[model samples]
Target: MQRAWVIQFAGLAAILLLLAFALPRYAQMVPEKIADHVQHHLHEKGMTWAGVRPAPGHSRSVLLNGSAPDAEAQQAAVNDLRSLWYIQQVQDTTTPKIIEPYTLHIQWDGDKLALDGYVSSAEDKAEIAEQIRSEFGNNADLEKLQAGLGAPEYWETLIHTVLLKEIKPLPSASVRMVGHTINFAGKVATTQKAEALSKALRPIEEKDYHLAVNIIPLDIIEPYTLHIQWDGDKLALDGYVSNADTKAKLVEQIKSAFGDNAHLEKLQTGSGTPKHWETLISTVLLEAIKPLQSASVRMVDQTLSFAGKTDTTRQAKALEKALQPFAAKGYATSVNVIALDNAAVVCQREFNRLLTQETIVFSTGGAGIHQESNALLQELADAAIFCAGTTILISGHTDDVGNEEDNFKLSEQRAKAVKGWLFRQGGVPLERMKTSGKGASEPLADNDTEAGRAKNRRIEFVVEGI
Candidate 1:
């Protein structure tokens, strides 16, 4: 028995050496060998072979050959090819996959499926993820997810063809969330984009878009920097389109001046608004005369100072009148809109207009005069500037935009709100002024669009006998 076993081992060793040599020589022949082998077998029953391509991440590729005239022949060829040891896998395939544009490349790391591809934005990412789920139904393994479709190369091409969509990315708009607030800090070409961003983010209940819209007194016409940030319940903002405090004051003051019953305070802090900030300060040149156009805003020791080339006396007086309501509303006020003289400059522009004309003003729905208004008023007072003690008329007017009565009421409320802020709050004597509402009866322009309507819905100075 021992001798027979030894002879059998020697025979096996010789056979193994011969087979190893034959396999090395045959490795090169597998492609054509396999293709020919497949075709010949299929031919015995009448058939042909079609296509082959590289399998991702491997030197060996898959070749799908043999076109069968009948379903049975097709299935049989596929089964025969798949049964071969040299063939990793096999399936029927069609042609013309050459014309696709987008390509998906994926890496299969054992732990997590690393899905990496160029996606334009939030929407694009969501869409592709959804499409993948729809096609493969969420899966944890490569076999179930991408590989389930076919060879890796085939799957990559298919996804690129069907999944990707070409879209010009919306320029990056910087936003930061501080606490419960969102603040914007960048420049977008259009105002609609800024507004849309704010509106769209309404889904998060504990947050709001607070903008620090920068505007120069005359250098530019449009807002320079539009900053946005998000917080737990609000928005924090910081940017540099220039005129930082000016933008903050303008938004808050305008909202307060117009009287937004729906007052909300959500803005907080950021940076990177530089270009827009400088552009904002330039806008000051757009509306006012040459002298006032150069006016600048500065913050020192928590106070805002206005510096410009306007008249020392007139601008100061205007500032006093403008800030009166905010002071009355119990805000710590200050201002200085004077010519480049030794004295501080504080120009009272809007409030005085309201007092004299009794025009109604409408707010943009979130905030009112805020602290800056009061500080502005205090500045005027400290500058010893005061408007004539005329029985100033505070009138609120709306354009022919919405309900006339509502506009009328809004106008009245706005005027009265200022009066309360000025006299009852800022300490202006009640007897010095009164409020009224004129609903869209006056038009400075055609009330067909926003600019026209805005002109029409102004709070102006209509002199009542002092």
Candidate 2:
């Protein structure tokens, strides 16, 4: 029994070893067999036979690697193999591909511009250099090291007429032309300039040739600098300007606006500053805020930075609005607008607190101001004076104890009485004040309770026209 078991085990082991050797041999011979079959057919067709490679782990797929003078001849060889049923798949690996025409490039930096690429002829090169000089001004640094067969007639015309003109305004720009496609990149001084350049190139877009543009605003150092200081007592001005004439005009305007209270130490240097800069500072920035306690204005390059304290929030808002034109034109700006303690905002909060704690009581149903509200009214008046260029809105309300018509009439009368008191006692102008009544239509608390009703029957003040 033991001898018979050993013979069975040996026979099984031999069969396993045979499979390991035979499978790889079969895998190795596949490509050779396919090569033979492919060669036999290729010989009859007068085509040379290149080697064949079987696809890894795939039984029928193979890579028929070969080359031909042209794509048409290569396709013909591939089509011949498709008729045979044995080869399931064939990937034709061929060489000598069709390529597009070469590209040309031009780069501009500061005052210098460099051109490097191929052109069809020496005349085309000279023409391109001349075109650059004309478009970018005579001061532009130009270098051309381009060579090739005479450029295509279309390319030569496009560079001279359209592309050169489009990139002229850019302080720094690069242009690349690939066949019919042209791409542009550069820096402009304003958002409007960038948009204008983009709009101009829209006509150049076509099915055969394409045009692309990218422009970033120049935001380094601005042309001039403005240094303004308000030291809680008086204002001081100093910094760089475009020229002596501009400085004289600006100083005169500042003196006119603030009178002898301001000091000027400004120097004029003809940097790259904008023409409308004086108008921007004296007209927009300074006009927004008056009666400042402390402030400073600094402008560098195309950016404006200001820090200061105003007596009221209204002044701050006006200053922000005044700077809108600069922001819209792509001037980077920042403002630190600090409202003083005596500002209207602080007074407004105090008024709200006083009204919430103690109601402005009137005698019965009459439009008489009560004595208890004397001190608070005086405080509200003091706040109103500081908040210049704003209007005061006084609204009155009453609990729903009577008919709607009677309640509305009483509210209106009470509001008018308060307005008269503010005008007579507080000295606030009538044109800067308006009075209204809601007859308990708008309430701060539930009217079902006595306390809530007391809270609802009150006078409220709102600041408008800020």
Candidate 3:
């Protein structure tokens, strides 16, 4: 009976040993048991932990500090052969503690970034870690920056949130924060931007907010004004160029005879009447100032005349000289010399009686128009002779450089407007005229560069059907 009992006990002992090995592992992973194995082994071997700080991944397993004398030995006690697999990196560090001789602390983990605690020399303790670069030098992930903290989620959240955010003790020209309240006082270019920022920060409703921003607009300085218009023989000052500088310039150009010319300032004021002799006199004087038909200025209003019977050659020279001032200032002209002569009364009379007639167009426009083209327009308009049933086709066109759709719209609109002015504004019947739009497609010049583009962007009128 004793022998039989011994055999049964031996069989039981063998079975128990087999179960011990089999149950601790399901396939290759018994993680809970592994942790217990590691913890128990380390404790038994007198391993010490200095810190368990945050790192940059989902798992918080990275050790920032340990005071184990042998990393492999400690790992062995924990049932892990991981440190021994890479023998060169298992650097041993120790400090003089009473219990153990030299407690080795790991200085690095392969070529990966080492946190502040990884650089433990007895003398080394920097607030931030010095990055231990990899052996593969040139092909480094230069832009992949590493930051401190444990789990990656924690570090990612921190960096992203603070990229452009005003950090605690926010920096600024005139903003101050106390507790959760912010006070701002300074000039801002626009109130809209400030209000937008305030709206974005409204999440912190408990915080008090105060802000003051000033706004200023600068749009009054015009480059230049269209003050004067003249054909060769006729001239006029637009009553609209009444700014102080333009008025002063016009007065200065007329010199001694035109002192304190009140019309200069009242050009756009529209106070003076053509029936008033003084106003009429000023208009006639301005008209006579054009050089195409020279008439002597007498400061005379009622009997404004061109009575000089000097020969044609001498007259042309004097007329050209008189026009020189307007010419230099971009008022080119083709005023009828016959109108200025005693031969004719009106520009139409001049064309019918003394000169051949042709349809003419005139434009008094901004400085951007070509000087030569502008001079031609005025000369043509002044000399044009119209009759009751005469077909006057004043075909207007614009420069061909804007958004394709917008240019088409503009061209058509302008053509319709000119047709309206001829029939309604100028009182010519609608059926006698028409309009057309040939946008940037019909450019007379190249559209490749600025100068050509400017030239292409012009307004012109031609006699189409007539």
Most accurate candidate by lDDT: 2
Cα TM-score per model: 0.27, 0.34, 0.25
In candidate 3, which residue ranges exceed 4 Å CA deviation? 2-227, 230-236, 239-250, 254-262, 266-290, 293-466
RMSD in Å for candidate 3, one decimal? 22.1
- Root-mean-square deviation (CA) per prediction: 21.8, 18.2, 22.1
TM-score of 1: 0.27
Model 1: per-residue Cα lDDT over 1-466, one tens digit each = 9999999999999999999999866765555555566556656654443444433333344556433333444455667767767766564663322212322333322222334322323344455567555544564233322111112232332233421210011232333332333333333345445555445434433223233322111233332233322211222233333334655664564344334432224332222232323323233211222324233344222223343334456764665564344344333334444443323212235345323443233346311444545654443222222333445566777778778778788777766766666664556677766788887887778988888886776554333542
Candidate 1 Cα outliers beyond 4 Å, as residue runs: 1-79, 82-99, 105-269, 276-309, 312-418, 424-466
Q: Model 3 over residues 1-466: C-alpha lDDT tens digits?
A: 9999999999999999998898655523443344344445445556544222222222213223355433443343333423423211222232322221111111121222212211122122221222223221232232323221122122222212321122212212233322223333332233344445455444334223232322111221122222343333333444333235545654665544433432343244221111232333334445345333333332121222232212244564565455444334333333334322322233334333321223222243222223344334434333332233334444334455557777665655555655554454355567755566666767767878876765554434443333
lDDT of each: 0.44, 0.71, 0.37
Which of candidates 1 and 2 reaches a greater TM-score?
A: 2
Compose the digit string of candidate 2's lDDT tens values, residues 95-142.
532224757787777576676666655566777778777666676544
On a 0 to 1 TM-score scale, where does candidate 3 land against the true structure?
0.25
Question: Of the candidates shown, which would achieve the greatest TM-score relative to the real structure?
Answer: 2
